[model samples]
Target: MKLYPIKSGNFKLDGGAMFGVVPKSLWQKTNPADTNNMIDIAARCLLIEDGNKLILIDTGMGNKQSDKFFGYYYLWGNDSIDKSLEQYGFHRDDITDVFMTHLHFDHCGGSIQWNKNRTGYEPAFKNAHFWSNQDHWKWATQPNNREKASFLKENILPMEESGQLKFTDLPQTDMLKNSPLGFDIFFANGHTDKQMIPMIHYKGKTICFMADLLPTAGHLPLPFVMGYDTRPLLTLDEKEKFLKLAADNNYYLFLEHDAHNEIITVKQTDKGVRLNHVFTCNEIFN
Candidate 1:
């Protein structure tokens, strides 16, 4: 199996919102904010090539949203899914599966795009089967008030409408071994309802796709949960359990939202699981 890092795009978000309740004095040290108090965030998706199957995890926020809507996020950077795919001699059409960790706009927005005539929306990857769990599909489609803004209809419905949407089998336990996507899925609810974190086995190493469960290295601390989480207390428990497992197993965490740190390893520090080493995608994948 071969792996590639697909940088969908970059944008800025309020540091306070990203770190949630964590004092700026603490988080700013790892994720420094700019003059506007916004921190850089990357929509770093992962691509796995195994045999004839090319699966993409997350699509980043697509370019379909209006300028006014995007203005709020302060979008930046030239890196795009197309460019990144081309770097690996591939294209969106080559993708067989688009495994979404969740239906949050930034993660699956790029799954759908405006049609040629701009008359309506359509699946962006014509040949890919968009993947989401049944629980998350229901949660995102019928979003609560707090998460309504993040779950945009335009970014979601098209996949189902296109008849290319598929659901992974939910495991009875927190972790699902040997999923349909050819990897294990660890489910977490604190960030959102049934957020699926992919655990991929490649090159004799276990690479975990850290969606929002652990957005950045700075969030290694158990209490550093995102304000967007529906259940912060649950997040604390989930993060603690996962971090302990990550440290004990020596797993390589593939961070999706951190613009600065790509892949990180954690160690059991006195303070708890702390960042052990940082590696770029090239260092680990290439």
Candidate 2:
């Protein structure tokens, strides 16, 4: 199996929102904010090439949204899914599975795109099967008021409408030992209901796709949960448990939203789990 870090795009978000109640004085040390209090973020997806299947985990926000809609996020950079895929001599059409960690626009938006005439939205990967779980499918489709904005209909629905949507069975417990995608999945609820964090065994190491569960290295602290999380307390528990496993097992965390830090590993420190080392995608994936 081969894994590649796919740089879909970059954008800036309010540092305060990204770090929740954590004081700017603290988070700023690791994730320095710009003059506008916006911190850099990356829609870093992952591509898995194993035998006949080429699975893509998450698609950054597509270019279908209106300028006014995108202006809010303050996007930056020219890195796109197409360009990133081409780097590996592949294309979006080569993706056999688009396994979303969640349905948030930044995570799954690129799964759909405007059709040729721009008449309506359609599945962006014509030959791929879009993967989501039943619980998250419902949570995203019938979103609550707080999360509805992040779960844009244009970014979703089209996969199902195109008859290419497939659901991963919800695990009997929080962690699914084996998934149809051929990886262990840890289901996290603090960020959003049933956000599946893929635990991929790669190159003799476990490379965990740390979705919103741990957005950035700055979020390693227990209380540094994102303000967007619906259940912050639940997040604290989940983080504590997961961080312990990560530290103990020496898992390589593949951060999806950390623009600066591509990958990291944590150590069981006196204070608790803390960042042990940082690695560029090239250093690890290459």
Candidate 3:
């Protein structure tokens, strides 16, 4: 199996919102903010090439939104989903599966794109089966007031409309019974309802897709939960447990939002599980 880091792009978000109760003095040290207190974050996606299947995890924010909508996030950087796929000698049509961690715009927006006429939306990965769980699918489709903005219809409805949407029958257990991608899935409800974190076993190493569970190495601390999380207390418990498991097993966490760090290892310190080392994805994959 081969893994490729598909960088969709970078965007700025309010630092305070990213790091909930954490003070600016603490988070700013690592993710320094701009003049408006917005921190630059990477919408890093992962591509898995195993045998006949090429599965993509997350798509990042697509370029379909209006200028007025994008004015708020300030998307930047030259890296795009198409460009990153080309870098690996592939195209959107080459993808076989799109495993969405959640339905947030930044994660699933690139899954759908404007058609040729720019009149309607179409699946970005024409050949890929968009994978999401039943619980998450329902939560995103019928979003609550707090999370309604993140779950955009343009990014989601097209999948089902195109007859390419499928849901894995994931149980409510902490550990997945059977993953659609043949990887173990860990579910967390802190960030959003039933956010699936894929844990792949390859080359005697475990690589975990740290969705919003650990957005960055700076979020290693249990208290550094994002303000966007609906259940902050649940997040704290999930992070604490997951960190211990990662530290004890010496797993490599593949960060989705950390612009600088692609993968990180954790160690159980006196305080708690803290970042032990950071490395690029190639360094770990190779």
Supply the TM-score for candidate 2: 0.99
Badly placed stretches (over 4 Å) of model 2 are: none
Clashing pairs in 2: none
Lowest-lDDT window of 10 residues in candidate 3? 169-178
Q: Cα lDDT for residue 122, model 3?
A: 98
Q: Write the per-residue lDDT of candidate 3 for residues 160-213, one digit (tens) a residue.
A: 999999998777578885587889999999999999999998899999999899
Runs off by more than 4 Å, candidate 1: none
Error of 2 at 111 (Å): 0.3
lDDT per residue as tens, model 2, 223-261: 999999999999999999999999999999999999989
Q: Which is the better candidate, 1 or 3, if ranked by TM-score?
A: 1
TM-scores, each model vs. reference: 0.99, 0.99, 0.98
- Candidate 1 lDDT over 1-286, as tens digits, reads 9999999999999999998999999999999999999999999999999999999999999999899989999999899999999999998999999999999999999999999999999999999999999999999999999999999999989999999999999989899999998999999999999999999998888999999999999899988988889999999999999989999998999999999999999999989899999999989887
